[model samples]
Target: MNGAPQVQRRRGFIMGFGAGAVAALGVAALIAAIAGDFSGSNLTSQASQVIRDEYFKPVKSSVLNDASVNGIIRELRKRYDDRFSHYLNPHQLRQFESLTSGRFSGVGLTVTGVKRGLRVASVLPRTPAQGAGIKEGDLITAVDGRSLAGVPTEVATARIKGPPWTPIELRLVSGSGGATRNIRLKRASVAVPVAVGEIKRAGTSKVAYVSYATFSQGAHGELSSTLERLDRHGAQGLVLDLRGNGGGLLNEAVLSASLFLAKGQLVVSTDSRTMGHRDYDAIGNPLSQHPTVVLINHDTASAAEILASALEDHHLATIVGTRSFGKGTFQEVIHLAAGGALDLTVGQYFTANGISLANKGIKPDVRAVDDPKTPQDEALRRALAVLAEKMAVENR
Candidate 1:
């Protein structure tokens, strides 16, 4: 009840229930036993009976024999229509934990599905993906001699990740070319860049431009330090770039908002049947009250949307660019006694104004589209223009 081992034992008992009667009683009878419809069919009794059953012998021999049980769990989620719910195997759980911790063993390319193949969105700095010259916009066609044409993006990404020092071959076509080339690279530990900033001239005045990659652990601390450095260097305004960001931890999202909002200001809230209603407020000191603009696009999601929505709702910053990705549901990672974890959708999140952002993303005040021919971010340029105008008005 208290530890993970206990939870695992409970899960094991549940699965082992009616093992002997499984062939005779079947799944329906098993459910009835669990529901207390049958006499002497309590959980413990049923579990003991199942464990002694001949069909359950393989389960006692190896975890691999639990495949049927795992399949059933997956089918249940599908029947419930919750695509966000996941039953991660041990290996996947390890990969996910690494990702959330800001480091993982992989080629270090952030990718999305495209018409032909998986498109390279961004290559992390100093990683194997970058080292192999896999720049943004490369379309991956195959992995390790396997053709990924028409394969799901999620499956392709899984094939790309593995233990460090392992070799992975990628066949890809350039974003602008017809020729396809194969690149062999060794996977290595890649750190996710959470926050980076620089000061840029906006209308003769210098404004800080900060790009937040994700809301990983300790993200607020990183962002606060970056902004503080910019403030010390005479930053007149700020451009918070949330383009291509896919969001991360929820608490980190609220913490990031705290950096710009007044103490105790409402950031977000959650609505659910089990958890009821919960509100999260900004707790830390305000970092910068300077005229600011937020840059967002279709890839900006979840926690990123939270920050954008909060800033816009509070009239704290001018939002620019396309609508956000609109991922407002929160997930709770429950570690199983087996080996992996369950990422279950817990609840839908709402902005301070009580608007649920589940399917309806945050719409920018000044919509700007990026040009396909140019490498420059047009949305960022528009944000700078908006910030410059605000700064000019404030000075006047």
Candidate 2:
């Protein structure tokens, strides 16, 4: 179950063309001619133009003006291997905004599609799903009397989410051939926690264990406050868990890393033909200098990878678990005047050590894989052991 959706930080402005004085005058004249045209035709033409001129790679002129906006995006995705870029219609834009802001209207159940139906992976605390007695491993066979046997997970998830106070009926079977039951739930706004923290006793040491869920808006503030609160409680070390974290805002990643790294340390850097090169540095005072261990898995990606790589490169934390999900690229959300927006891949980011995490994810210093059959979290236990060793060395 993914707690946070993967999204990139917002850049303040769109890329502007740099032209010679005479060329700039000509471009200005052309802009003046098209500025008054606010029709759908004008919007489509403008979108095509932007994609042609500003995309990371060159696009053929033939694919620019498709009959529909969705058609254009589909062609781009199929032809150019552009998996990240897409056009969000007005409704989708609102949903995206709601998710990035850490709130959404849903039953608060995360499920994965299976042959039978959608398998419930988790039910968020205090949510409608939890109130309705939905449990992990439950097979959701139908929604509103419609069988979801072969439906895609995304489609099923969409059906589960609706306007607040709206009722959703789900038919579910208990794990692996248990009883079947139907329940009606009213969707409500769910506020996902950016970070959940607890202090654990590892041997004689008190280690602060924090599971950072996403890099969404205001995530840095929540993480910083959590760290501060844990630190005040006499925690001696830290175990940062980033498993299943798909990632969110890039700026939030940098700001979250700033809570652990020293001021002026480079967090990440970006490069592209249109956006050029830029470096992000840590800006705030660190909350703790205690020995730290970061837990990662194959699901960690994008901004999560950025933070993990920064800490690893700076020798600030010992990375544990399997390799991360490589997602080195960055995206920019450009809002359109005619509603909706273009979420386009704008550039690629590098870690603090100048390594691109595109197809190559960060390798952990200490590797550990958990066995699902057992209830114990082997990776987390390994992290605690590593943290104990680091703390012992520091005490010496």
Residue 306's C-alpha lDDT in candidate 1? 96
Query: Which residue pairs of candidate 1 clash?
Result: 19-50
Cα-based TM-score, every candidate = 0.74, 0.69
Q: Write the per-residue lDDT of candidate 1 for residues 1-396, one digit (tens) a residue.
A: 122132123323433233345434445544655556336565544554455453435454234424544565568656864445666666766656655344447888877654466777678888998889886667898889887764434455777877799999999888766568999999997777878999998899999999888888899899999999999999989999988787878899999999988988999999877899999999967876899899988778889999999998899999999988777787787887866666777788999999987757888999997764577977678889888898999999
Top candidate, metric lDDT: 2
Off by over 4 Å in 1: 1-81, 98-104, 111-119, 137-159, 163-165, 171-182, 338-340
Lowest summed lDDT window (length 10), candidate 2: 6-15
Which sections of candidate 2 miss by over 4 Å?
1-68, 78-80, 97-104, 109-123, 130-160, 169-185, 337-339, 372-374
- In TM-score terms, candidate 2 sits at 0.69
Candidate 2 structure quality by residue, lDDT tens digits, 223-280 = 9888889989999999999886778888899999998888899999999889799999
